[model samples]
Target chain A: MINSRDILETIRMIQDENLDIRTITMGISLLDCCCDDIDRSCQKIYDKITTKAARLVAVGNEIEKEYGVPIINKRIAVTPIAMLLASSGGDPVKYALTLERAAREVGVNFIGGYSALVQKGFAPGDEQLIRSIPEALAKTQHVCSSVNIGSTKTGINMDAVAMMGDIVKEAAELTKDDNCIGAAKLVVFCNAPEDNPFMAGAFHGPGEPECVINVGVSGPGVVRSALKKIPDGNLTDVADVIKKTAFKITRLGQLIASEASRRLDVPFGIVDLSLAPTPAVGDSVAHILEEIGLETCGAHGTTAALALLNDAVKKGGTMASSHVGGLSGAFIPVSEDAGMIDAAREGILKIEKLEAMTAVCSVGLDMIVVPGSTTSEVISAIIADEAAIGMVNSKTTAVRLIPAIGKDVGDELNFGGLLGAGPVMSINTASPAKMIARGGRIPAPLQSLKN
Target chain B: MRAVITVIGRDVVGILAEVSGKCSELNVNIAEVTQSVLQDMFCMIMLVDMDKCSIPLADFSDIMKKLGEKHGLSIHVMHGDVFDSMYHV
Candidate 1:
């Protein structure tokens, strides 16, 4: 039996608290689309993605209307273009253009997987794809790119890390006029998940099915609201409240994923148990931390609060859905979350503190904007540090930094919408040029030896 | 298929009659309804069977929403499964 209290609670969560399904990402494998000629491969890739995801947006809308829950983005993730580039052996930008066309045709908000996985070393097409990311992203509006430059098993690829530093700078420089949006669409990951449904880091890995539907659920505001009801509760009470709230949120995600999978006739993939926040008021993971008794998001003890919240979310979400994968925890994207943005502007959320938080949270250095004069080596060093955290901890971490080209530490770069406005956060300018120039791989950690 | 229709607003005269009349017009069968008045606010939750409705649930929801707007009420219609999945296992 359904009660009025439950129905009203659900309605309030949607209407006031901004509860939503962040995305319904269809992962399509482009491995079979590869051909000897670049044009033929592009054609095959376009046809496959367009056909596979043709009904994605429409079905997402139908579900949204029927369920009364907003599905924010309908996206597609394909096999990394680098693998196909190895076969086609031409300009990788062609694949980006094809993906953009397919995304526009099929009406997805973003098409991810313009990517390369060079965690150990650069393969035949890996370097080419990495070098072309700036041009590819600058040329296309709806395509997202990621490069996995390190992992626990293979360690950090310093050469790829160095190259990605230049690539991230070039991407931001190329799109400086558009609020440095190119870099916003590009992510550098360590231990990247294969079936992540979020962007700008989502991709269909080689291990995935030919076609699958993955769902990302979000409800930071709902969790925060639940905590507000327990103002004098102990820390354990806080964890229990978050666990119950996360369970409800993930159940909705599972329901929607199953419905979409059944409708699209594609296999159902995991439900990413994430608390993804937007710039909208009342929708922030940072606010959840504050609700846990922090003066601000970057205050001391913020890491402990985040660690508790992330663990509780995963614990509750694990039981709600049969399959839980991807970066299943709290996402603290500096720009996307309203509370984080305010904290950044107030100088409370420093980059170093964010790096520490990433050790406990889901992603790392996400949507952070640095000064234009900051060198590529600094960005690479930042990636190395974040990658080291993920490599050592054996968790997924990513860096999506925008070099606010022609902008300074205090200036704000507004991309609007879900990408949000990034306040240019200060970076340490001390050079790491020599370290980056060494161009050698950091050996895998002892944690990787369990196999 | 069944849906949950919730109407919330300031206490109004004949709000139930108005809503149930629309359901009858659309051939939707009302399975259950619960209403309460707290102070000056009125809240109602209705479980309606839409398997024999005259219009699609989406369209029916829009119609009910428009009707609520005319009477200054907040309205929402969602699949019952959303509630079952969230509140239940």
Candidate 2:
């Protein structure tokens, strides 16, 4: 049996290792809010949110107080607004603004639903929603966005794919000074989930109930610390140990979610059994990848190893929680995950290799640090490239690059705890700036219309 | 007309501050609270004191709605009697 102190130690690893739950998103269906009248529709959306999300942040805190475990984000996911308000016929931007206003009114940091589903083909509202990406994200302080351009089951939605390529570029242009921050607010997905609690990635699936609570489990440090105990452990045995550990870890999440739902009176939502990696030194998804056998972070076998690791953890967590969903895999965020930093220092991981890894697992390039000296055009180019992968492959992908204020390649800067330390990785410096400065929206690619 | 305040949101500034402010304004005492996040979403739970409160449940709910929207949130307030039976029972 895992000792009680071991549990406390797990909790401590999260604290000392800069680990915490990445998200605790409540899923609320907005189907009932659908209507032709803008005001009436707004009213329904507002009522549904306030009625269902009133105590969300508060209850989440109470649990934190008792367990001494921190929840980093308290958020909500509603039905894709496109599905609900597309029939407004024209100018979905205004409705999106209304949704943005309501999200502010309710007090959640980000409200995700400026979304569309073109996996098979574009829905009328999806086109409108896609067009609203740059404007909606730019105008609103807290409205995150996503587009499901494809899915594994559906293969890929070519048209949706093509459009998103341009959309990401547009969003990057809209928020160029903010680190091309708009791209951070959106994701392109394949086999998009209905009840992912993390965003700009989360959305209420059509199959979900009116309202439910979804939990995202994290503590890369806890897993990392556990690994330290068994240094040089056999790879096969590591899988068994990881499964048992994940079972207990996910059970704790299940308990917390169940208790929260029972106390709050909402139906219990699923547990997002994802080992969300953070910038903290001890809690790194890349560390797990390396421990599973890799000479460096961006080694040749990275993706195959990550896919296997994701599958094993899911098998373990599935046994732990019946209600599991969301992006339940190892998050390989370079700046935010500690192990990647070590690999970068060791000259083992490279930017291109990380890109290849994204083809398989982890939320696409996240918390990556590039030099401030790099031009905005290059940043936009990077965004376009990453989005292209997500769009064509039809999987959820995002980018959060920090253009370090005065940093250079081969130099390291520490963000201090949980945010993780980073090495400003080298970016191609051949002045792709000229190409990016040309800056017109990349037209929707021809591959976008498979459906 | 007892109610339960379940707060699920992120670890951001004033999540605790704003909710507590509302509870006190409504003359609702904080019976219990659990502020924590899971799955990248934050949440909390508070048992309100409606015994001597002058406001109606609907009014309290509206005040909550206004405050919640001002901050970009999704809030849900349930009657304690109803909440307990629905969830606990």
Candidate 3:
């Protein structure tokens, strides 16, 4: 028998605490859509995505209304475009335009997979796609792009890393008039997941099934509220609370994923157990860290708190869902998170401290706005450092930095919406150019021999 | 399919009658109902069978929400699976 207390608790979590499904991403494999001619491939890609995700938004709405749970974004991730580019030897921008059009027509928020995987080395179409990312991102509105420059097994590709710095700079410069929005849509990844449901890093890996429905579950607000109730609890008790809260959140995600898959006649994919924060007050991963006995987020003990939170979330969420994948942990996007924005604006959250936090957090240096004068070499060096951590630890890490063109540390760039405003955080002016100039792969670390 | 309809507001006469009357008009069968008053504020939970309802789930929810607005109460109709998946293993 269901009790009133349990029902009321669930209702409060959804109504007051912002518990929500962050996205219902349909991953469609475009491998079979490849053709010799570029236009033909574009047409095939458009048709496949449109047909596979035709009812995605409708199904999401139905589930949302029925369950009284908000489904935030209905998105689609396709097989990385580099594989398609290898067969259709032509301009890759055509693929981006087609994806943008399809996204608009199907009424999805974002269409990802304008991407390339050159983590180990540049394949036939890898370099070409990476080079064209700036143009592709600048021209499209709803399309997201990503590039994998490093992985744990294969190690970091320094050549691609070096190119990405310039690519990010060019993207920001091209869209400078629009708050450098182009760079906001690009992600440079280390050990990028094959089935991430979040953007701007989600791309359906080549190994993914033909069509699948993946759900990303989020509730930083719920976790924070739980923590607030046990203010004097010990560390173990805190972890227990987080675990229980995450379990409930992931159960909802599992329910929605199954419902969406059954309705769309697609295979059910993994549920990403992520505490994704938003610009809304009381909805922040950083706030959760603060609730865990920190004066503020980015304080000295932030990394350790984040490490505990991430592990407990996985422990609880793993049991709730049949399969848990994607970057399943706490996301600390600077701009999109209200607590992070406050911490950054007050100079409490430095870039280096955030970099250390990323070693334990789910993603790395995400949505950080650096000074426009900061060099591309600096950006590349940041990526290399982050990739090294992920490679050595065998965890996923990514970098999504936006250099605010013609702006300095004190100024702010407001992109509005989910890509919330970011206060330009200062960077170390000391050049890492000498190290970044050494453009060669960082060989994979020894996995068997633990030091 | 069954749904849980929750209504919370100031205690008043005919609150239950108005809600049940709307359900009867839509051919919805009420499986169970529980109501209580705390400090003159009313709270009610009604489990209704939606399988034979005359209208779609979305339409029915909107209609009930509008009815709640007319009566100055907060009403939410949601599928029972949400509570089951969340509260139970």
Candidate 4:
């Protein structure tokens, strides 16, 4: 027997509160697809991905219908393409094109893992792949790229950091005609997770299984609505409300992950208990913060508020799923959240404030647009600052800044749907050219010496 | 297998009969049903056994959705396991 109350609550959460499975990413390892010839490797990679993920979209649709939960994206992640590039040793764009073909063939929204892991230092194929990101992303429609340039165990790779600045800028410039969508598809990371299922940053790390299903759950609106019932609750009461809401959200994710894994016959990976927000009016994470009694999302106590929210979500979610990995925390992508966008447009939310917020949340400086004149060195410096935070705290942080070419402060680029639209926010123009020119790895902190 | 069907809309006569008629046509047994009328809005929750259902749950869900649309109601059909897994340990 099922309780009518629980049934109605579930329905309300889905229909009214905008609760959803953010993504069901199928991680397919392409190491076995590697070959000496680039073309041959591309073919093998395409064949493997298409064959493995052929039923992903169909299964996702079936589950969405049967469970009555919206699964927004059916995506695929592959082992970092740099490994395959090392063996194949040809123009890296070949792999990107092949990935695009496979994604379209299998009818997936996006295919990630056109990526490299140079957290320690660049390897044989790393620099080539890194340099080609701009062209590759500009050429392909659904391929996402990421580069791990720092880690807690092995300090920051300044060389890769510096190069990534130019890469990020070029990625945007190449696709400037299309709202700089290229740069939005690239992420530069520190302490990057091997099994994150979210896109623009998701890549099947080399450490992941041959093939697996990872799920990301989303419900900022549900959390906010839950908090709304207790308007005068103390901070203690607030955390409890958030934790309870997170528990319900994650249980649904665990159920969906298990079901998807069973249907696909792939190993179940993990449930990413993330409070990811969409541009929908009611689905903003910043609204949850406001519901927590903040004046605005980027106010003085914003960091403290985000810290509490992030911790409570983890505390509640850890017990709901058997395995919870990925960047499982509150996401505050500015353009993707309506509240954050409003804050940014009003100048209440600045880049520096967002940087501070990232230290307390899951990701770092995501989906921000800077002026066209913002130099590559400045972009590299921003990456360095974010990487330092992730390195010291032993957490994952990433930068997905779009240098909106020919755009300036107060201008806006509308990418629309999911990627959303971003106002061109102002950034400090002080040149970091001297510091960026001094490219060297920043040593790992004492936190890494635990052993 | 069992599913939960929820219909929410304005209160109207024959709302229950129309839904149950479709369920019976599909060989689905209505194990339990609960309904509430707040002012003019009506909401119903039905626990249905689909062990001997003639059509797939997905198809039945679509059919019910269309039926609800015809009457300006919102209907949802979900597996009982979804509720069980979420509400229970």
For model 1, how does the per-residue alpha-carbon lDDT over A63-117 read when each residue is reduced to its tens digit? 9888888999999999999999997899899999999999999999999999999
| Candidate 4 residue-wise lDDT, A133-187, digit = tens | 9999999999999999999999999999999999999999999999999999999
Off by over 4 Å in 1: none
Whichever of 1 and 3 has more TM-score, that candidate is 1
**Candidate 2 CAPRI classification by DockQ:** incorrect
Best by DockQ: 4
- Against the reference, the lDDT scores of all candidates come to 0.95, 0.68, 0.92, 0.94
Show the lowest summed lDDT stretch of 10 residues, model 3 chain A.
A442-451
TM-score on alpha carbons, each prediction: 0.99, 0.70, 0.98, 0.99
Best-first order by DockQ: 4, 1, 3, 2
Better of 2 and 3 by lDDT: 3
Name the 10 consecutive residues with the lowest summed lDDT in model 1 chain A: A61-70
> In candidate 2, what are the lDDT values of residues A1-451, reduced to their tens digit?
1122343344345446654556678888888887777677777887778878888887887665444346778888888878875665556777667767777776777787778876677777788788888887777767778777554444455455556646766765676555555656777665567888877778888888988888888766666666667877777677776776666667667767886788689888888888887664566788877777777768888888777777677877787787777777667767667678888777678777877777676467776666657665566556556656766665555555655555578766564434466787888866555555453334444555656
Error of 1 at A76 (Å): 0.4
Task: Report the error of model 3 at residue A401, Å.
Answer: 0.3
